[model samples]
Target: MKIVELKNISKRFGTILANDDITLSIEQNKIHCIIGENGAGKSTLMKILFGIYKQDQGEIYIRGERVNFRNSHDAINLKIGMLHQHFMLIEDFTILENVILGAELSKGYKLDFEKSRVTITELIRKYDLDLNPDELVYKLSISEKQKVELLKLLYRNSEILILDEPTAVLTPIELKGFFKILNNFKAEGKTIILITHKLNEVKEISDKVSVLRKGKLVYETDKEKIDISELSRLIIGDIEDIPVRNKIDNGQALFKDYITVKNLSLIENGIIKLNNLNFALKKHSVFGICGVEGNGQNELIEVLIGLNKKFKGEIYPEKLVPAIVPDDRTKKGMIGEMSISENYFLREKNLRFAFKNILKNIELKFIKRFDISVPYSGCKVKYLSGGNQQKAIVAREIMLNHNILIFSHPTRGVDLRARDIIHNEIISERNKGKAIILISSDLDELLSLSDELAIIYKGTFLKVFLFSELKEKLESDRTSLLENIGELMMGVVK
Candidate 1:
């Protein structure tokens, strides 16, 4: 059955036509994927369906009946639920409380917690979801929180579930588990709509795929007809292979030991965040930490940047000037209310003159170099798009002449064009002999950028793989190094 259908949907934001007469149909009980570059209107179209945005022109049909959703509640009542990329759970709430929120069970005048707990337990068992009802949201890991979100939809009796980048934070082993859960959903005749940029995942889980480019549905095909390369080409047009730069021949060492961490162990909320971690960074090379999010990646970055001092670690180069781009940029990387120039100044302490005056000329030069699309240096960071905000951060961080750069998910939430620009910028920094620690969940990125990749799992570096040895292992072992790395990331021993 065709559960949802959109006909000639068009939406415009000022001069930008976000969606241009796009048409799509989603079937019942199938994993339908929507793939696109960032800002390609995937989010906009989903928003229109969820009643977050009003379409200028188009008709949406649910179950062959034309309907207009005024708000998310209407869509929810129609058995539709959406899981955004960013979690929407209250940190203070318990797992059961977060799941049953807004749709609480009430008896006469009071809320019925007992009844809800019993019902939630039954649902969790039925879905094979493992979660402690009394556990606080703040205590759960990223993957656990994601499972909670899934349970939220199931609790609502949502027949059609829309997940945006569901596996972006998951490790390889966790992803396998996730796929198993998805298969269970499919078996139970539940419809799923997945929006993601990971091409291999689309191939693994989706039955049908749709490609959106510049807000239009440009390609639709079955999984059997599509491959990763083809999908990549469709989304970003033709692109050449990413060439690995030759090792620089500069014998002059900018710094013998750029950064070092010893015996670093962070204990947060009674959890061993990172355990006895030790690493040394050298200039002119990128040290890539390949792991699933929540596997001490955040803690490692925090300890290095002097943000979280609640750790048993000796951090050398403690006072060395460093620029860091956090994984969750909206939360830790950039200040929304501040202007781009202010962010620039924050990154480079000397951007302001001794008189405490902003140097407009110097800021503009950095912005242009980083290709930040801002109307003016004084424009508020929040006003810029996600890609532009990232660009601004990169611009500021690189221009500061910081000896070490810590980039977490550098190209996250960025469009293809902007992602390319960011990649080039990372390359430029490497060429300049700046020591970098690149932490990312994107496997392809890790393979492409890192000379050495280490998988961090449950507060420890489980395994390290040299990129040069990956091909030989793949040929001899008859298994994927990436998959093995993913398994290690999820604490699965192979």
Candidate 2:
């Protein structure tokens, strides 16, 4: 049965027509994935369904009944729930309190605390969420927070669930476990609507897939009809071929010692974040680190950038200033209010020569080279699409021309076209004898770009493999190597 249906739904944000007559149907008890590039109207449509936005045209139907929701409360009352990209919870509250905040049960005007607690505990056990309801929200990790959100949906008895970027924070091992839980949800007759960018995940878990381009439904494919390569083409319309940068051998290149960290140890809140970490970078070499989120990647970056001053370590080039692009683009990379050109100027100190110029002389050059699509460089960075914001950052960082560079999740959340451009630029920089430290959760990207691959588990480097050895083993038996990596990540091979 069609559990949910949208007929000619349209939404406009000022001059931008976010959703133009989008018609879609989501069946019951199936994983329906909606795939699109950044700013391709995926979020807008989902927002409309979740009652966060009112459509200008068309109607929503649930089980053949036409309905209109004035706000998220109305949708929630109707047993529909949405898990946002960033979690919505009060840090001061416990998990149980956060889940039952708005949806509280009362007996004769008094809150039924014991009943709710017992129910929450039962639900946690039933769903296998492994969450302690008494735990403070602030103390939980990303994956734990995700489970709390899921628990909220289950507590509400929401039959239809909408998850936005659900797997973005998951490790490879955790991702498999997440999917297993989702599959269990399906077995229990709940419908799932996932909004995501990862094509490999779409192919792996989705029972049906829909492609949205320029705010219109371009294609819909069932499990039997789905094809990842064809879906990739749909996402990146009219784009040139995206070559996977797997060429590790760029001929014998002269190397110079740039940055080295010896016995790096950071103690935070009495927890050892980095356990005697040691690494060295040489010119033209790309050192890629792969690990689960919250396993000290952010701390390591901060230590290297001198944000965390107190650490037991010896850093060669102690006063090193390298080109650094942080993982969280909005939080650490750019200010939303600033124009694209102005952001560039903030990074490139040498571009501050022009106070009257909206764009730096060097910023304009790389903007065109990186293919940042915006009406003007003077436009606010926030107004530009996610891909363009990323492009702007990449262009600015590259223009700085620092010998040592650090990139964390450089291609994350960008479209395939932007991803291809960023990869090419990184390779070009490496070819020019620049040392790069790449930290990413993407295994394919790490394998493709890394001169040396390191697998980090629990704040310790489990194993480091040279590019040649890895490449040979990978080429000889790709499946075995991938399985080996997965085991290593989960501590199964430790």
TM-scores for the candidates: 0.86, 0.90
The TM-score between candidate 2 and the true structure equals 0.90
Off-target runs (Cα >4 Å) in candidate 1 are: 105-109, 238-255, 268-270, 337-342, 353-396, 413-421, 463-487, 490-494
**Model 1, TM vs. native:** 0.86
The lowest-lDDT stretch of 10 consecutive residues in candidate 1 is 350-359
lDDT: worst 10-residue window of model 2: 104-113
Cα lDDT of model 1 by residue, 324-421, tens digit: 88777667777889876677666665544522234566557766665555544566777565556777777777777787898888877665556666
Q: Which residue segments of model 2 deviate by more than 4 Å?
A: 105-113, 243-253, 353-357, 360-379, 382-392
RMSD of candidates 1 onward, in order: 4.0, 3.0
lDDT of each: 0.79, 0.82
lDDT of 2 by residue, 345-410 (tens): 777776546475546555567666876766454677786666567777877787789988898888
In order of listing, the candidates' clash counts read 0, 0
Pairs of residues clashing in candidate 2: none
The prediction achieving the highest lDDT against the true structure is 2
